[model samples]
Target: MWTPNVNTFFQIFLKNFKTRKTDDFSATRNSLCVTIEAVRKFTTKRRKTSVLSKKSKAIGFIIMSAFGFAMMAAFIRLAGDLPFTQKTFFRNLVAVAVAAVVLCREKVGFKWEKGNLPLLIIRATCGTLGIFCNYYAIDHLVLADANILNKMSPFFAIIFSLILLKERASVFQYAAVLAAFGSSMLIIKPGFSSATFPAIIGLLGGMGAGAAYTCVRALSRKGEKSARIVFFFSMFSTLVCVPFMITDYHPMTWGQFFCLIGAGASAALGQFGVTLAYANAPAKEISVFDYTQVIFSAVLGFFLFGQLPDGWSVLGYLLICGISVAVFFYNRNLERKGQ
Candidate 1:
């Protein structure tokens, strides 16, 4: 007769329950209790192994998401030789068209309530600014450097969360901000063509993005439909880009056009993937995987642009990632305490 440990028994029982029947919270709770008991009994090494496994899974998802975003960066850089506004115009056009086709096919029309329009507009404006700044940075900076700098978003998000959302940040979040700023300075050292304007744009874009996300969180509370929000973004951005599309636009080569398509499609897919990630996993768990963007950007930059970040830059990457990891765990700990 084999006597299984609580955790082992819990795993088997949960697996069987998931396979056999409907998802009942009572059953899940019982299984979870068993698993917790087993966890309590586990040796330190076993517990460490379990923690590592969970981290690995979370890292995998984040890495995938970050890679998708990096691909968007590469494509944007390739398309940036065109007029900035024109690039924006076509990209938004493609995205809007794609979204419209999907909505029509699915018969998922959005009903716009008057009260929600302001929130929707605000979200769209923030997204548009972020995309615009990112594209402009791609045009001006080395691809890897731009990506590394853009990773500052999470850091900025921390501050914005404090100011706009009135949420207190952990010490780890402050450390992450310092690390990101340090990394950015390494990339754009002083007296390097005054990258100040572009950097400011990037930073503001990041802050705006955080505010947009906060609004999304708020809307989610009120049961606002994400599809409606997305629809507003698609429609509004396309409308805004119309003047840019008409003036000073040049014909693009097939290659250039294809690159724009790639950027647009990746943005659409990445948007959906990121939404799902935040929904399924804790932000702390998902955010750490964002570090993979540096790796992806480095690889893509070297292969496509013949640009490589220096040792200082690489070290900076590590520092930024380290801080971000610390922040994630800190937030996770806070969440555990129900704060």
Candidate 2:
């Protein structure tokens, strides 16, 4: 609700301190004593934070988003006996509730133009399917493997941007995309195996997410607020899935119900975190940190599920992560040259 800009936040936060002198006596400014030592201490900490730049903040956001999603996935696995549709419904329901609270507090519009209705519906549909498929994959596949497969979204996002946004991809970008696909194939090794199906589904989950995000970008270009987009998506998904959930829902215990709710809460944080990451820095500059989801999932899977990747899977991780990091630096260098 009414998030202030960086300048406004700092200005409001430091106003009283700014008005004080080095020898100002103790006095309450806003229900708390403002002593000279407290002012000096805050100033010292502020000066010590000179090295914390926007890029650092963006990377921090990306890492947080990754971690949040990893925790979400782990919880989804913990609730594996439930239907994917049920899990998706709860996840979006919780997100919608949180978003509703913020929207009501901010008094934001719950309505949009009829023209944007189609795009919003398309976005919500794709996003709902993406979450459904991702949760299914998490239940069927190893947590780390499912996460790695879902990480294909960034590559597919670029591809979707090319097709839907008429964006041009450079040779290096194309190379990285190809390398990511190759590595995904290596990890899946899909032939005459039951694991093949879930791996394929995980890849499709990434595709769905990629398409949904492409729609999100288009919505942003049309000046839609991110909060509004999230709220609409969550509301749409919850409504559409409720009927299906009622028909096929398996009853979950109280513990499972709360875990799924926690998964939903985590998903909301992940969504907000990634949104902030890209808002603060260029996508290329910070997207590499998104891969840390695989790491977090790997650790969680090891302890929670006793899952570990084999030799080929490890190689696949290296290939994908290496290409992603390379792509980031390559784009950064190109930007520098253009400047």
Candidate lDDT scores, in order, read 0.63, 0.73
Where does candidate 2 clash, by residue pair?
none
lDDT of 1 by residue, 1-339 (tens): 124476676675666567635578877776667656655555444655555455455445556667777787688778747876677666666667766776678777777655777777887898777777766766775544455556666655555555755656546555555665666566445343467787676666666655665555455445565555556776787788788777767898888899988877776655544543433343433454565566677778889999888887688677767766676666556554545
Runs in model 1 lying further than 4 Å from the true structure: 1-65, 97-108, 112-114, 140-152, 180-192, 195-202, 276-291, 320-339
Q: Which candidate is the best by lDDT?
A: 2
Best by TM-score: 2
Model 1, position 205, has a per-residue lDDT of 63
lDDT of 2: 0.73
Count of backbone clashes, every candidate in sequence: 0, 0
Stretches of candidate 2 off by over 4 Å are 1-60, 105-107, 138-149, 177-201, 276-288, 306-328
lDDT for each residue of candidate 2 in 1-339, tens digit (9 for 90 to 100) = 122356644554476556656434453344124444455565555543432355567668878988888888888778758888898889889989887887788888888655788888988888888887887887788755776678788777777777887766666666666666667666656443369899999889989887877777677667666677889999998998989987998888998999999999999888767755655554434555676676677678889889877889788778867876686666556544542
